[model samples]
Target: MESGKKGGSMESEKKMLESNSILETIPRDLVLEILVPLASSSLSDICNTKRSCKTLNELGNNSYVLRYVSLEGVEVVQWEPSPELLSFLPRCEESGNPEALYRRGMVEYFCNNKHEDALKFLERATNLGHEEAAYVLGIILLCNKDESKEWGIELLNKVEKRKRSRNIGLSELRNKCKAIVRKIWLNNVVCPEEPLCSTLACKNNKRKRGQGWDLSDEDEQVMFDCKACKWDHERTLFHNMLCGSA
Candidate 1:
């Protein structure tokens, strides 16, 4: 058991180092700037990359990155309405990368309501230490039609256990997940049969309302009707100009 634990730790450390080395070859500050706003799930890849080298150790050591990512994780775990924060999400899916795959799953599961496949990717992610995966797992267990809060809490507790050793707590995480679930569920229950009252309002703003007659349309009609009149007027003006010249 001791050798197994030590071997696992060493392997993880080595993997962290190798990943960090690749990132170290590049400038650190630039990477941080590009990474700061990225969603937590995506950031995990960056962290993993940073862990591969000693020179990149500082990248992993950044408390700001950790805090931001943690807050994001909390929001997702709790199911907060975080449309704005989602700007950090990667525009394209990095499905080939396991970490990216999991992040994509989380975004789909919560924000976009693609729950079926979310479970598959998230399960794979949890095996790889993607904290967000654990959060989702807890939620699924708790909220599944046949499941109970007890099972959900157990999953959450497992996450907390991992966090406690790492000095991260599940309290905030649990709260965030619960909050998100509440918002989504409430939205479902109260959501309109057709659409929200806001949809028409949104559409109204999108469509430029004609103040009276659309000036462009009126101008077109006038142009057609006045074709003969305009031609006659031009002819008379030209004749008068010729007469005056003569």
Candidate 2:
């Protein structure tokens, strides 16, 4: 029985070797075509296999392939958003990867709303010269009520200046994102009046309007005299004027 088990295991190993040899004989383009069909079909295995070869890796990373997987409703994290995807980002940064840095900043930004943590990654990416990172960092800082708004403005200004100098087209998404951040910041931080004081002032105004009385000493005195006259119509009107509710 042990000998039979050994023979079966050897046979399985031989079959695997033959299969691998057959795959190696196929042309590169044919390999990509085959893998493309299977990319969304078995995403986990595709990722594992893609990591093992440069040509296959490129095919997997192709924007076309990515779009297909995305449209097929493959979960982003499974088919595309794996941490190993960061490997491509560093290459982007090396090649003046503004987009890559922006994505990295976004990942950290959305991971948590921790401005301090996002700032560290964003600042580094910007300093290393990622223009999009600068722009995104600006928006993040702008939304962060606790952060230095002045710095946020400066970063945004820098992005504009850099874009003009580099002749990069205006990124509509970045601009829109920044505008959203500004609107939200205004709503939450800068726009509203001081709550306690505004509320108190509003209540005071409402009281005055409702009661039809000014909160002045003269108004108080008149109210006192009127109440006094109503309570004692028999007493001297002069006494009523002198004391309240006689």
My TM-score estimates for the predictions, one after another, are 0.33, 0.34
The digit string of per-residue lDDT tens for model 1 on 1-246 reads 999999999999888767666776778787766555663556566556565566554554464454334333433333454664343333212223334446556556655666777777777667667675676665455444453445545666677567768776444554443444443322111011111112334432232233232222212122212222222222223223223332
The Cα error of candidate 2 at residue 224, in Å, is 57
Model 2, 1-246: lDDT tens digits are 999999998998776667566767887667767776675465566677776555566667665444223122322122346565445445443444334444445444544345466567678768767665666666545544554545866776677566667765334434443433332212211121111122334433344345553322222123222321211111122122222211
Clashes of each: 17, 1
Overlapping backbone residue pairs in candidate 1 total 17
Query: lDDT (CA) for every model shown?
Result: 0.48, 0.47
Give candidate 2 misplaced runs (Cα > 4 Å).
1-101, 166-246
RMSD to the true structure for each prediction, in A, is 25.0, 21.4
